[model samples]
Target chain A: MADWVDACATDDIEEEDVIRFDHGSRTFIIVRDHEDNYYCTDGLCTHEEVHLSDGLVVEATIECPKHSSIFDCTNGEVETPPACENLHTYPTKVENGRVFVEI
Target chain B: MPRDYDLLGADAKSAVANGLVTEDWYRTHLDRKTMKALMKRADQPAIWDTVVLFGSMIAFAGAAIALMPSWWSVPFWLSYGVLYGSAMDSRWHECGHGTAFKTRWMNRAVYQVACFCMIRDPHCWKFSHARHHSDTVIVGRDPEVAIMRPVVVVRMAANLVGLTDMWDGLKRMIRHTGGRILPDEADYMDPVFFAKTIRTARVWIVIYAATLAAALLLQSWIPVLLIGLPRLYGCWHMVLCGWLQHGGLADNVLDHRLNSRTVYLNPISRFIYWNMNYHVEHHMFPLVPYNKLPDLHEACKFDFPAPNTSFFDAYTEMLPALWRQRKDPDFHIRRQLPDTANPYHDGPARAAA
Candidate 1:
């Protein structure tokens, strides 16, 4: 059974930003898109596991800083080359300014 | 027998079997905040560098064209060639990594421009370099290994002036015009990009043809000199600095310190090479942008072998290694890790001793 785990405060991540969140053992990212919608995805790039939190966030897509592999944070779908596999995403919720992710 | 460096050959399979393909190399771990700061991208440094590079190129080219047919123009032409022929290699590299500028389009724009200047098909080289980083110095896996074992002295000497390199580039470009990818290239290239790779080659042929036509119509060597010939004339700097990157280092090593060199270069050469003198650092944390390489080098310098003090120092060390490798292919310059460095985090590399 999946439980909504508190990832971070909604205000902790700025708009159009991503912050790394480690829950138990797995690492994920809390991304606040340009429209202020909260999203969650695996923090490591599918290609080489370089942290996606270090990557450039352009609206909805996060570009890998190492090789420029881009992915849609919303769906975790790879949007670029050199990285064929899509990322694993989690359902997220915002409750009273705190962000929770069902991983 | 000499080791096979062919990407599709036996050693390619060996690299896979040996667990050398994309194995995690040792890193000097830093906090996420620090790493994020180091990886942050900005546009100003790249903007200033690009403006200076192109601005000087235009000045030199204009002066050279005006003074053409006179020996007085030689110096200006040489300067122009270094910018167009040699330095563009670094631009192609940095922009290809998408770290040169914060804006994605800017990196793409410069990458395409640099690819044309270097006579490199952008897509082909992009994938080639991606593989290079993924499996650096692994025999038969890394296509960009500059000096393969037994050190073909003749080929190395010829490439100083880009004779063999440009010749091969021309041949590759010709093959690309026919919409054919070399079988070896196909091994690592994604099928998704094959069409655009061929398209890029076709576009280059048109551009080169136009430059040649202009020269013929004007009854002058000016147009070709401005375009195609510079890659031959001014490629010396590229080869000089590029060879020092991994010329005599241990091959098939999972650790970059074992296979890459960091040499101190003069400021002018650093500018020309886009700070790639920090070779080991660049290979280790490729996410770090070119402008931030010095900072990254500082952060991790304690964890690796000390950088060569100078170009002279680097070559002095490499020359004898190369000479010996010609006799015994397995003989290589073993890197001495610093006391603070963690033990080499890798499987036993062949002949690492």
Candidate 2:
């Protein structure tokens, strides 16, 4: 069984944008791709612990503002170095116009 | 005695103790929407410019090769070198900031190309530039200070032909390839980038070695001329334009208006320099794209000192100031701002006011 928490409304994140979702002490980044799909991953950049939400989403990749390391939003895979580690991806779903992520 | 400008030297420690490092610097106010508009990045301008730049480089190099061993070859090669070596400096700078293009990959591609042209290690220079923006012209903290007081005339002259920069760049690349980072570089660079920096250096060395081997195998200067050697011959304009940005300007000041110069240059120079002639505006708003710099300048001109009328006018003021600074290290060019401009409120200027 997975604990799925309500992150935000479906309309909260626009295309090519990201929002930071905090549940208790944990934080995650929810990104909206160009196709309007939502994906969730660990919030911090593996390179320098910078918030990925502060960065820009280009196509399907989220570029870290600090050092420009990019991660694929779809798979939380490291697409660029300086960040050699892939982010942990969480299961995300939209139900009844609300976005939810399994933590 | 020559002043110590080293980032890890006593001067830097003194700057920290004197409350210079990481202190809040003055900024001209911009409306939120206007600021947002200026920061907006676009790919069209960058793509168009990239096409033009590379297109010009290829055309010029072709002309040079066709005219080889003739006096006509000199002009074509010189043009190619300027495009490759000089213009690449600004391209490297803008792309490194990641604000030149809306697409991340596009910026990265241009950055890599410009990095190779300028002989800069992308990983190291990227972090160094971030620090430069964070602590602009802060004595002891800034790694990119071009002209230190008691100006070293001979060294500055040597830099005009790229002798100094190329030698230093080679030394740094060798050191990086050997798995060593300078203490000053280590001071500001994140430890996470060290391995990547080394790897990049190794790649650059291999490329250069290959180019040299190609030239030796063919017994022709063409390979070197097209690749590594152009940086030395074509770097004069870059050094010339770069010195105007901050040479003889105020140092250790919290206001960029005091520390940086914005000179009006011709369209060609602006294109080559990528609008960095608006140096103060760029420093003030590092996120602003190069295309929007003129707009940013227009928006904030009231708060800034008047831009130099032209490059010649800027050098007229700068040359004499550099001359005086050689005798008096404390001397600097204090620019006159318009009455409409806000007063600079840093250091002694504030107390005097």
Candidate 3:
């Protein structure tokens, strides 16, 4: 059985922005792209464990605040150096003005 | 031999014990909104500047090559060198921080170009600079400390022509190409990036080898002139500005006010240096973009020592201090802050006067 947890209201995240969603023991970063599409990835930066939610969401990537290593919001693939590993992405869905992430 | 200046040396353990590593330094207070505004990234200014800089480099190189075998070529080469070797340093620095452009790819592209021009490995210097910001001027921690006290006059003189740094960079690149990470680099850098660092070094080696081959095939100095040799001649301005950054300032201090210097340079210098003349403010607020630095300086100047009126004024103060420090390693410029500013920590003994 898959767990789909309601992270936040879709309106809570503006276009091309990210918000940290803490659901019980799991933490996820929910991002809304410029087209209003949603994505879910591990909340912390793979480089230094800094919260990716605190970083900048530019274009389709999230730039880590600490070292500026960028990760693709779509697939959580690392697009830069200093961070070699790809982020674990979760399936995301929006229903009735709410964002849900399947973890 | 015990190299006390090495970041991974035994002194590094002492620095950690003394609470220097990763500790927060003193910062001037700015409202959150103001900070947010300053930290905002933009692409327009950086795009415009990059085009101008690269365009100028092309123009100068073209002129130099066209005028070759004539004395008229000298000025063109000189102009090319300053733009490539000297100005690229600031671009390398700002782009390394990833604050130069709003787009990540743009920043990365410029960083690679500037790194090659300056003969620095982007992967290595990136982490090194991050450590620099984390621990500025803290002896045994800051790898970028330009002057190790009881100043080595010979080394300093060599650096005036970029000899020391260029030689060091080439040697390190060669070592890195062999897939051998220095013990000191391994100390601060994460192990996972080591393989990538090695790969990057290999790529850089190939590019340099190709450049050399081009020069050999052409039987002209033009190829090396366009690539490696400029680092020696055009580097004077870079060395000049770099020395002023922390030359006569306090060392092993947590307060940037006590360690970093801020100078007012001419418009041309500011453009080339990317407003890093506001060095103290940049050190304190590393997230702020270069374009916003002047405004940030305006906001924070009340809490800082007055900016050195001009480069000449700064060098005048710094030269004498360096001369004195040759005999007294404890010697440093004690900048007087305005009354509104908070007093520096460990005040009495560290004050210059």
The residue ranges of model 2 lying beyond 4 angstroms of the native Cα positions read A1-103, B347-353
Which sections of candidate 1 miss by over 4 Å?
A1-28, A32-37, A48-60, A77-79, A96-98, B348-353
Give the per-residue lDDT of model 1 (tens digit) for B17-113: 7778764666677766677678778999999999999999999999998998899999999999999888999999999888899888999999999
Report the C-alpha lDDT of model 3 over B14-80, residue by residue, as the tens digit. Answer: 7787766643567787864566578779999999999989899999999999999799999999999
TM-score of chain B of each: 0.97, 0.97, 0.96
Clashing pairs in 1: none
- Model 3 chain B: worst 10 consecutive residues (lDDT sum): B344-353
Local distance difference test, each candidate: 0.87, 0.85, 0.84
* Candidate 1 backbone overlaps, count: 0
Per-residue CA lDDT of model 1 for A1-103, tens digit only, reads 9999988998898767789899888888888888999989999988778878867676887887667798998899997668889999999999998999997
What digit string (tens of lDDT, one per residue) describes model 3 on residues A23-91?
Answer: 788677998887888999999877657677756676678877556778998999998756778999999
* CA shift of B48, model 1, Å: 0.8
**Ten contiguous residues with the weakest lDDT in model 2 chain B:** B344-353
Query: Can you write out model 2's per-residue Cα lDDT over A1-103, one digit (the tens) per residue?
Result: 8799999998888777788998899889998888988999999887657777767677678877545667998888987655678999998999999999998
> What 10-residue stretch in candidate 2 chain A is worst by lDDT?
A61-70
Please list all clashing residue pairs in model 2, or write none if there are none.
Answer: none
| Rank by lDDT (best first) | 1, 2, 3
DockQ of 2: 0.13
